[model samples]
Target chain A: GSYTTSSQQPSKLLFRQLFEKESATYTYLLADASHPEKLALLVDPVDKTVDRDLALVKDLGLKLIYAINTHVHADHVTGTGLIKTKVPGVKSIISKASDAKADLVVEPGDKICFGDLFLEVRATPGHTLGCVTYVTGDGPSQPQPRMAFTGDALLIRGCGRTDFQGGSSQQLYKSVHSQIFTLPKDTLVYPAHDYKGFTVSTVGEEMLFNARLTKDEEAFKNIMANLNLSYPKMMDVAVPANMVCGLQEVESKPC
Target chain B: GSYTTSSQQPSKLLFRQLFEKESATYTYLLADASHPEKLALLVDPVDKTVDRDLALVKDLGLKLIYAINTHVHADHVTGTGLIKTKVPGVKSIISKASDAKADLVVEPGDKICFGDLFLEVRATPGHTLGCVTYVTGDGPSQPQPRMAFTGDALLIRGCGRTDFQGGSSQQLYKSVHSQIFTLPKDTLVYPAHDYKGFTVSTVGEEMLFNARLTKDEEAFKNIMANLNLSYPKMMDVAVPANMVCGLQEVESKPC
Candidate 1:
């Protein structure tokens, strides 16, 4: 979170941005004081970098109301389970299709209300079968949802790999075109990872510049097929490690 | 070892070459049937791709012999341990400083005699602490060695990382200039990994054109420092996994 000042107005909201150095993962904490309990939401946090996020949450004196994962990340270990351990009372949310345990299994069109702001779950499963994007807005007042948390579904310049578990080039094409690209052009697109420059971009920017997503299904498939040569080197270890949501295992040893 | 035909001649020796598709790793087998009781030597093999190499060896009716790793690899897993496991009597050889379990550990000037061929171990630790290059010649015909298996220490157009364990930029500079560069300019340099177009180069070719090794030590260090920013994403898991030599517990578990 790089926030330097706070808003005094009761109706206004604040969002703190955080980065995980190793994977360059971005985690955001959205807070609204207008809510009765000073509730907050954490999005796509990384494992082991929670202390800093928690400190920001504490400094703002907001109760962690919900912890959500846009999808199970292929690039870095997830911190959902770690956050669950620390903030026991907070509800854990994910897409209903995800295999991981979640307190609230959300789906498309599902609205999660948090005071003056609301998060609308949009099933955008191109990157992975269970991936989703959370559109945050204030309804008519903010007529268009100006922000989206696009997990790994859509990066600034590249779409996620379609060769991983439950990934489909066709599905990804449709998701990007119908659900994401249809969003307001000015809508801010925040992704899970950005290997290249710039942390965020507008929906219009990605539609115009994202090489893979803008291509037709056949062209997209060709690109994906060529990328099949290199499998994730960490897949063998990461998948199993992430299965239990990054819980540090107690070694089995001689008692 | 890309020979196509085998002949029955008391004076002749046979060899076979196998390439692993994933990492483009090459393994070579050299054998002389005049000494039927003696086994052949396997060099720089890759894991899980032994069937092809085994078939070639069987075609020549040669017994499985010794296994050697030019160096501990960073890009691909090595199959020295697996080969030793499958071939009961086969001994594994690596640099003495490698600290892994091997039947024989050799240093520079140490000769490994296998029938008609003599492999001379040359300590080339710039790549990693125990990195070694094997200087081999056509025994009596070519009294002087002409081929060098420079594992990552020297690539076709570049060199290995000095930021890894026991790696020193200064040591690499000395090793290249004082040891490898001192070799005959026409000596063949076969590097362990080549993602680019080249598979091999002459000592003179590398000395004249290699961007890093050809430059001054300070300039080389600056390039290395910048390249180091893109750290191997698999470093945390790969090193520990490779230490035990390519055995993954997940192989036994369901995907």
Candidate 2:
């Protein structure tokens, strides 16, 4: 009904970036304030910080509809299962490639909708086999701000290493070039983890400046294959817990 | 075998203070390097940082003989259970009053030993019902240095809040004056948590300058009773997990 861009209209949509200091993980909360119900969605919720996130949701008077993960993470345990436990009926969503039990297993080209807003899913599996980027729809307005939740595929100045759990430097390069960089140069890139305090970056900035990912395909693969990074500290415990969508092994068993 | 004081003989003993930034928690590692076995013990291990701790233990080539908690913590999950899963035969020790299942239930006057070094347990409840201070024994050398692991019962220039989990102002005051303040003025005090980047303090400094605990008994009680602090963010999860000595609920029981 209105020609004004919703991105500029703060009252129409709600968005927040929450950080978990322990793991340097960023959790994004997006809600459609335009809707009467204020339907909301959360991305990459850390288990230990659920109390803070939930309190925030209450304070903002938003009703969370989905808790989504870009992939099964290794650095920190997800709060997806715990959030579901806390707010009954909130859907748990993840990529089908993850093969983890989730309420909704989304694939490439899938659209997750809330009220009038939708996020177009684009599989960007370089960091992990199941990694995906959620791109916001431009809506009816021509100048609406487009955001890409890049997960670990494309970091601010670097990209996720292609050494863990089905990681492939070639595939990651293709995904970034084809799926993410193809978007508008002004599109904002938000990664799942940032250790050096960076919060957000734009596609054009990464395209010209991302030290690791912007290189030619052959060079990028060589860098990722030989970086020889150490295993993440929480990998042993976080992986198993994240596979079941962050449920403790005991909690997932039949009662 | 030698007349040199233990503190002066640095090669005979190894001590390190590890910090968990999220909680500002300090985990101390003390080893009796004089022993042929290179026996080591960790105090206040945090769950998320277990891998880091274990890596350090491996790097030092020390045999981890015990993992002890200052008390059941509310800020972070203790790594006691996780450490047990990683290293077998390492005893888990805690105060008997904590009622948490541990490999060893220690009381006042009891000692935990690693090679020739020993920690003399001193009951110092009030921060929590089961808080205890572990005072190191002085060796044969007169005027040998002694250290007290005071946990939350005494901080560098402050003390823990006496408002939750059976906390008491009067008992905290009495415990500090009778149990901790009575230690030799030169005795070093290592607290379980320090926010101001302080690594160590002496009993004399705290006795004269500890703003909260240095006051007269009645005045100390008044300060603690009116602090009115917010509940810890991790209390709900940490309390239950710590009760079973850091065992995840699922691992402890049948479904």
Candidate 3:
């Protein structure tokens, strides 16, 4: 009748994708299988769904380790700050190039480790100057296909709009082509947000089907420029809150 | 860029969860590895998102062989008829007790197989007269934790309402305890619909955390009777349409 925490599953690595409907944001939970303590981390958790996400962690008997952001988001405040406030000792991580405040700062070539699993950081800036993609280990030696957490640089059939927040279409085009597309085609791509109900995609699928990125660099830039998209409704409030490890003024509800 | 179907991955099995937002329904695409033809099946696909679902199936280069419904849903139209129309020769499956006209009728103790993988059919009829939970094999021999496609019988933290369509809270309580909950505690539980943005839960998690079924049978029945749920707006249209293997009069849009 109530939430229950149980150490039930053993030897299975945890990888969960949670959603926040209002913003269509995707939050990822990753953990290592061999770690008895069940150290875990959340990526791109939204402020509105922090309680739900934390309850999940508690129910699964996982110890929250870090709250990670691929970049400073333009929509929906990040849950990293609230998560820290709720779960003491939980650290926040952001890219050093993001120039945002966080407990830990990372850059290209850095690896974030939890138990036996690790994610390689890749500088993939285009939608923003500091966006990065986190990728799990890939190779014939690995047990599973690689996973690439491409925040806004890439999506299922499209890429994020490069119209504001120091957005550059050219940089994004180059960033994805060089950094993300080059990964093994089978690598699972988990974007920070999806609007079309797509939960996941593969590098190969995007390489063949991605509407914007498949175009030449010039064509991609023109498409980005000509598309007169509306300004994000939550950008004004979300960007500021997300910039400082997600310190939101609103205490009760999401902005 | 356009949609591309690449035969890229060599070894990984495919299991994707697709969402149709209007009804908060989940559609599962499951396939067996080791099959070069990439035979696949869909579970509880919604009609409104048929185009999106087909595109995904095509992009993954999976051949649709079966479209199965755990039960005739009341919230949304089933995509089975449309899928069969588009992908010729695809079979539609439903329980025999449902009295629905499908290409194939399955009862308990049956195994639906594709390539090397098979889902053991479990008769968990509580939410409706003909609800079935599909589960991959458990025991130490399986590759990973078993997955139970609970449909509407059992949800993440809740079970389906036993209000209409021969729904009996008593039968549901007994059915879940005997059929679904008795599976391995580590088995992954995927429900047919989720109002909350939860995607997955474990057998143990639901066993301990299920808000409805965790209560005693009498208490569970009382909760079901007192729910005072609104009359389903789509039931009149959805029920009649889902009866004849999901044939719908509306051609262009969802009912």
Best by DockQ: 3
**DockQ result, candidate 3:** 0.29
Provide DockQ values for all models, in the order shown.
0.01, 0.01, 0.29
- By lDDT, the better pick of 2 and 3 is 3
What's the residue-level lDDT of B28 in candidate 1? 62
Candidate 1: where is the Cα deviation over 4 Å?
A1-11, A141-145, A247-255, B1-255
User: Using Cα atoms with residue i matched to residue i, what is each candidate's TM-score against the true structure?
Assistant: 0.46, 0.50, 0.91
DockQ of 2: 0.01
Docking class of 3: acceptable
Report the lDDT of model 2 for residue A115: 70
Per-residue lDDT value at A72 in model 2: 90
Per lDDT, the best of the predicted structures is: 3
Candidate 1 per-residue lDDT, tens place, B55-126, comes to 445534577767788776666666766666676877777777766445677787888767665678888887
All-Cα superposition RMSD per candidate: 22.3, 19.4, 6.8
